[model samples]
Target: MSVSGVREAAAIWARAKARRDRDPEPATVEATAPGIRRRLDLPGAKLLLAERGGRPVGFALVAPRARTLELFYLAVDPDAWGSGVGSRLLQDVEQHAREVGREVLELWVINDNERAIGVYERAGWVGTDEVERDPASGRLERRFLRHIG
Candidate 1:
């Protein structure tokens, strides 16, 4: 992802969170873009964007960690929700993991975010017993994992 793409992805992330009513203040790209860029700078990290009509609709960021692929972020524009954009982005993430020789893909989702959790579950990701509190949002998050080869 380029500099501009990171900004766009950040906007989508913020919008998705806001649409779910996750934050009262809602996040801004100015605050989220840096984190996205920092993760993208990591070794073996990949950012996959789903575009429609030459415009970005969703994105997924994954990085290799140990023997698994860690999904750092996945977001779809509110306008594109229920349009299959998120599912396509997830499929791309799984394919990318397979190409990188990583059989396991893992991610953390806020437990209250049922929409996102449902998406992951439909994609065959299983929620594990591991859970943690997000320091930034003070929300509970559960780890989800899937195996693909």
Candidate 2:
């Protein structure tokens, strides 16, 4: 993904988070763009984008960690919710993990984000009892794993 693509993904992330969480004050692209770019710069990190009609609708970022792939981010534009864009991006994430020789994919999702948790569950991710407080948002997050081997 290029710089422009990072920006687009950032916008989608902000919008989706705001809508999903019903945040009165939503984060802007400026707050997220730099972080997305930084993740893309990480060694072995892969950015997967789902586009429709030649426009980006969703994106996922994954990086290799030991024998597993850590999913750093996954977001779909609010306008595209319920349209299978997130599911398609998730399938690509799994394919990328396999291409990189990883057998497991892991991610952390906010504990109260039921919609996202449902999506991950439907995609074969199993949640663990482990939980952590996200320092940035102070929200509890739970770990989920998918074994693709």
- Report the Cα lDDT for candidate 2: 0.91
What tens digits encode model 1's per-residue C-alpha lDDT throughout 1-149?
68888988999988887888856665888988988998999999988988999999999999999989999999999899999998998999989998889999999999988999999999999999999999987999999999886
Worst 10 residues of 2 by lDDT: 20-29
TM per prediction: 0.94, 0.96
lDDT of 2 by residue, 49-116 (tens): 88999999999998899878999999999889999998988899988988999999999999999999
RMSD of each: 1.4, 1.0
**Candidate 2 Cα outliers beyond 4 Å, as residue runs:** none
Model 1 lDDT-worst window of ten = 17-26
